[model samples]
Target: MNLKKIILSRTDAIGDVILTLPLTAYLKKVFPETEIIFLGKDYTKDIIENCPFVDSFISWDAIEKNAVSEFQKINADAILHIFPKSQIAKAASKAGIPIRVGTSHRAYHWNTCNRIISFSRKRSDMHEAQLNFQLLKGLDINYIPELEEFKDINLIEPKQELREDLKEILNNGKFNLILHPGSKGSAREWGVDRFAELIKLLPKSKIQIFITGTKKEGLLFRKDLVVPFPDVVDLTGLLSLKDLMLFIKNCDGIVAESTGPLHIGSVLGIHAIGIYPPIRPMHPGRWAPIGKKTKVFVKEKKCSDCRKSGRCKCMREIASIEVADYITAL
Candidate 1:
């Protein structure tokens, strides 16, 4: 296919958008002359624009306000819906894009999309990044890239400089680590008690720790986690998304659940240690950070008792001593 312009639509959360970045890298490799426009939410604009492979970014909000006009102005040859959105699919069809790619599972795609690829995200054993490549089948690209191939792909380039106050917090002599204890209800958390225990176990003299999250999360854990540890720096609610990315780039590593910042740390080639449950779909096997230095701590056994609840006893059971030892070794 001799395509000139392609819009990669993934209007989703941070981690989902991060995983979809590899698709742009693959697209660039196959179609060197083709322009890649990433259609994403406003919150993810920084991430998409910073990607070296992405040529431009279109705001999904704008598309929602005026789908046909917004898409018509793009004049794209194709649009791949990496994260399926019904309205976006309908808009792409209404705009008459030459090749509209989406999943066959979506009944709406039968009418809206010209090219539909058949696959089940929940049933597939592939990693999130690997599964993203399956959507490329719509473009006549049959390759499903291996997880190892992602190690070589340079996805994020943090352009913003770290703030002066944040820069001063970095210790050149020690490993500057970020401990994100909350997931904002996205993934099952590793529990504040466990994180507090992990902090106490770490060698404070050899490691500089910083706790990061939204202001709400900060207030929620401040009393139990931050107040107890006077040495730990509190950066909650202080960082914008761009600041967080730049900050993660400067840090040595991060420990969190399957969240955006963890993925950022991984893509930046830092030691990103993720804590996860053994539950299906949410397990590390499916959503693990894609980086050369990433590590995952999950229970060996599979149990779905907590599948319906937000809390996971299995994830909390991962010992603080084990995670501390790995960080210390790094």
Candidate 2:
């Protein structure tokens, strides 16, 4: 099928959107003439803006209001429904996009999409990013990249102003280690109490630790604090998404539970240490960060259905001292 323009729809959260970028870059490399348009939530626009492969980014919200009109304006050759939104599938089909692509298992795609590829994420051994590449099967693009090569799909350097600000944050001559203790409910957390204890365990002189999360998370931690929270720098409420990327860019490493920051750190080629449980989809095998200097810390054996029980022994079993030692060694 000859293609000139295509829409790559992934209206998902930050990490999911970030994972989709490598496929975007790879497609651009293979089909240099195909204009790649990304469909995502308005909040994730910052992440797409940084992706050099994406020719344009259209908010899914904007398109939902008037699908046919919007799709006509986009006028793409095809639509790759990576995230499987039923409304989007119907819209693209109604728009008469010549080659509508999606997975066969979605069921909705059977009616809404003309070009469907067989895929099942549950039984697959591939990482989430690599799994997104499977949609290329419909286009007869059959290669899925190795995990290490995902780093090459990184964004252009952080903005110049962000770089200048980072210099000051790192002026203390200590290794900057970003400690992200919140996961925004996207994945199982490594516990804030555990993070505080780990901070106290790390060497004071060698590493400058920074605690990061959203303002709501900061307020929750503050209210929950029994003793004063540790002596690390707290930057929970302030940074924009772009600012956070720059901050992670300059830092020596990041220790985060399975979350957006961990993925960002990985793509930037920084030391991205992901703290994961042995949980199924959340396990390191499925969600671990990919970078030159990335590592995942998880306990042995399956972390079976712990979120429902309210007590996860395996995740809590990982010691603060062990994590501190790992960070300091890096």
Candidate 3:
């Protein structure tokens, strides 16, 4: 029970990593002296580093290259497989880190992990953040946090300063809103046309809009969304992850599907609005942003038709005007 150092392993995308941060806050509450080391992928390094709860970050790539040796170097008292990887589970066991926590569902965890918790993410109705708390049962920590408790966690604090050019782009008078139209094909998109419509609805004098995405996503929607709206700033492919975090911190709000920036905006205490489809597991009920100023837009009904398709008609059906109205109200 007197654990000094623990590794919270969630080598996943930005949003997933962001969701896992609240668990660190709770862990710190229980064991204030415990050194929290985050195990994440190279791309999500910035997200993990920004977390005030995490003491250090160890790249999953390093562990994958030399699992046992790398894990042994840390000398962690416990390792939680937040995102179960067979390689990590095996290595943690080999390294003899004492407590190894993972879900019982994964067949490999049975052999490698000593502390296995019974829970199914797909079947459970808990929010993604809440679901992560189930892993704590492995450590004999039974307290489950309510959703409201997450608001004051201060999960992500942007340490990076914005560049001169990026800093200048922020409109002090207007509501500086960011429109992230792509999810890297991770979630059901609200489509470029709807985003364009939303942009058009918001008055230029009142809302300074910025479009963010990868180079490929920008290229895909450039002619249709960017060129047509000359007033909107095209920051796609320009800002790095750290830069984006800094920029979001300065901005007033952000609107996107279930993606990294949306979660980042929420954690920063900005007006983070998420558009979601009413599909099982993917619905807002499961993956909504946990923030003081977060809002979700989704059709209040069950949807199974677009469960497999990324281009969800149900998501698109949530009118652009409705989103615009909500933003203006905020």
Candidate 4:
């Protein structure tokens, strides 16, 4: 591989961005000296900073404003469109990025991308990370590595100062559990009532519970979950994304609906139990957390209610006691 500097563009949600990191990891294994540039939204900067393989981060907004100059500044040898956006594709084309890779199914890619791979992500049985690797077919990487290979990718450790502050709420012998009740409308929630019930089911003496989410989500959950537990800590609105990333590293486990924090917890090697609905694309098979201690709770068969109603109780059906039992045992 003659590639020196390559840009992997994925300007999407947090979970999708997490799944795309393995691509950079795999490339670094094959081409150790290559510079990896991640072109993504401004909000995902912290995630880019955490990756050792990534040499730099280019904001999508900057690319949109001045694609030629941005590409000129870095002199990227290749560009991979993991999450296809017409503007980025066109910009890469205009900048004359030598080895522009994109999916053949996307009509715009034919005109913009120099190299294209024929693959369908929706119908494939592969995990999202594996499917993302398929876009590398143009580079003669024909096979997708297993889920375990992706899990082996390195992640940043928790900051020392962040751990010291968390010591106040974390018990010495108890399991530190972070319970996130909302999904920020990213995915269908498992319901706040279910999360509250799960909290009650856990042994307070053996478990330290902490609730985390945006301020708005905290307000939504405040009515039912306001009453304090013996060891439950409410940290919904206080922590920043950077702090949350470090905080997850200090915890023993995390229980949340399919969300960004769940992915972060799993990547950080914490026991992450992701509650998900059995819907296509959103199912565990596609987007489950990739880690040694990851577990998913999704309905077994086709969800009858959600298929018709567009709202799922399938995830809610996963009993709180069952999740609580597993977390305590962890």
Q: Residue by residue across 1-330, what tens digits does model 3's lDDT show?
A: 999999999998999999999999989888999999999999999989989899999998866979899999999999999999999999999999999999999999999999999999998899999999998998988877899999988998867788999989899999999999999878889998999999989988899999999999999998878899889999999988999999999999999999999999999999999999989889998899999999999999987888655568899799999999999987
**Estimated TM-score per prediction?**
0.99, 0.94, 0.98, 0.95
Against the correct fold, how does model 1 do in TM-score? 0.99
Sort the predicted structures by lDDT, highest score first: 3, 1, 4, 2
Cα distance off (Å), candidate 4, residue 59: 1.6
User: On a 0 to 100 scale, what is the lDDT of residue 238 in model 2?
Assistant: 81
The digit string of per-residue lDDT tens for model 2 on 1-330 reads 578998999998888888888888888988898999999999888778888888899998877899888998888998899999999999899888988999998989999998899988877888998999999987888888898787655653454356565567673578888988888788887787888788777887898888788998888775433236454677888888888887888888899988989888988888898888887767887888876788888897965868687455678888888888888887
* Model 1 whole-model lDDT (C-alpha atoms): 0.92
Regions more than 4 Å wrong, model 2? 163-167, 223-230
* Per-residue lDDT of model 4, residues 1-330, tens digit only: 799899999999888888888888888888899999999998787877787778889888756788877787788899999999998899889888899999998999999998989888887788998999898887878878999876666654443457567667777688888998888878878888888898888887788888999999888887666564645788889888887888888888999888999998888888989999988777889899998799999888776567656578888788988897887777
Please provide, for model 1 over 1-330, each residue's C-alpha lDDT reduced to its tens digit, 9 standing for 90 to 100.
Answer: 899999999998999999998888989989999999999999999888999999999998866879888899899999999899999999999999999999999999999999999999998899999998888888998998889899878899877788999899899999999999988899999999999999999998999999999999999998877898898999999999999999999999999999999998999899999999989899988999998899999998979989777789998789999999999998
Q: Give the whole-model CA lDDT for all candidates, comma-separated.
A: 0.92, 0.83, 0.93, 0.85
Where model 1 places Cα greater than 4 Å from the true spot, the runs are none
- Model 3 steric clash total: 0
